[model samples]
Target: MHLLIDQGNSRTKACLYKEGVFTDVVLSELTPTDWLSIKQGLIGSVAAAEQQQQLQSLLPASLAVRWLRSTAQAFGISNSYQQPEKLGVDRWLAILGAAALYPNQSLLVIDAGTAVTMDWLSADGVHAGGWILAGLHTQQRILVSATAQVEAAALSLHPLQPGTSTTAAVAEGAKAAVLGAVQQAIQLRRIERVVLTGGDGAFIQQQLNNNAVLLEPKLIFYGLARFIDNN
Candidate 1:
């Protein structure tokens, strides 16, 4: 059994996989009991140093842990960044998952977490680079912080209609930004597959209303499994 941990800016996911298929998943830090019988583990983290160490301490000494980092190339995916190591590991791993899930098809992999990241991967396993933007909540927070007039409000998911009030306008604007980014990305490239992952992926898919778009929240794990296989 292998434990795959994807530690994001706002959340951490620990999954138990047997033979490359995950059997269990936890959103918070795993207990020592959770590590029982696990022999090997892999962690891909973009969290703070303290958070990383907190999780690291929870693992059993007997378990061999591998910290996954961005590289120039791996698992057939060629990263396009000039400094490949600077590429976010979460995005890198998600691209690996997208490549394996939809082989030979150009893809737009969107990970909508604390920040929204959209990475384009070619059919031939080449990463053509991607975009990063303030996420839905991040946009809202910025609007409130930067402007004195904008106030925080609980906004629910609604159709993209013109807003009548200040709160409504703020809500609609944030969502529109995400939609606009997606539209611009697709128009710039030929995306054969659109895969959405992360916390707000469902919202993007719902707004897209495209039956072809796939929602795979566990995409990072798939990438981790592929990485393990290559090793």
Candidate 2:
């Protein structure tokens, strides 16, 4: 079985893929012990070393372990960015997965998690670059931090129409800013297909125009797996 590990800022996701289909999935906070436990059955694995050393150690010596590094190697995508390697692996993987699923079509990928990332890749397999912005909670914290007197309240996913109070205004503003940033990216890139992923994808998807595809959260994982398979 192939183990795919995605170590992000908040959590680590591990998935077992047998043949070409995922068989098991696990999500846990970044902890060495947790990873080691999950590594027991993994024959081969891929991850960022700094975030996956424990898991790597648990694997058999014969098992292959590959670390994902930012690279300029064309994953069949034309990169329009001035510094393509400077892009995050998560973003690259997302775009790669999007392209693999919808090749030769202008596409936009929006991942709404701790941070919202909007990336664009041409159908012709070119990375046209993208943008990133703070998530709802992050944006709320920024507002409260910037203004000591303003109190930030919990953000609700209720469709925002108008703010009824100051706290609601802050929540609405945060949502609007994030959604607006994503919408702007889509417009600027002239993307034809929009794929939404991440924890808050559904919430953000609801706020967006009905032109986006709500993809499985494992879109990046699928992309990474495809990258490994092809390379």
For every model shown, what is its TM-score relative to the native structure?
0.93, 0.81
Clashes of each: 0, 6
- Tell me the deviation in Å of residue 18 in model 1: 0.9
Candidate 1 lDDT for residue 99: 90
Q: What is the lDDT of residue 54 in candidate 1?
A: 90
Q: Candidate 1 on 133-182: residue-level lDDT in tens?
A: 99988999999999988876565667688878898888888889998998
lDDT of 2 by residue, 36-104 (tens): 443323222223556467655544555456756556755667656567666777787777778877878
Query: What C-alpha lDDT values do all the predictions have?
Result: 0.87, 0.71
State how far residue 144 of model 2 sits from its true place (Å). 2.3
Deviating ranges (above 4 Å) for candidate 2: 27-63, 209-211, 229-231
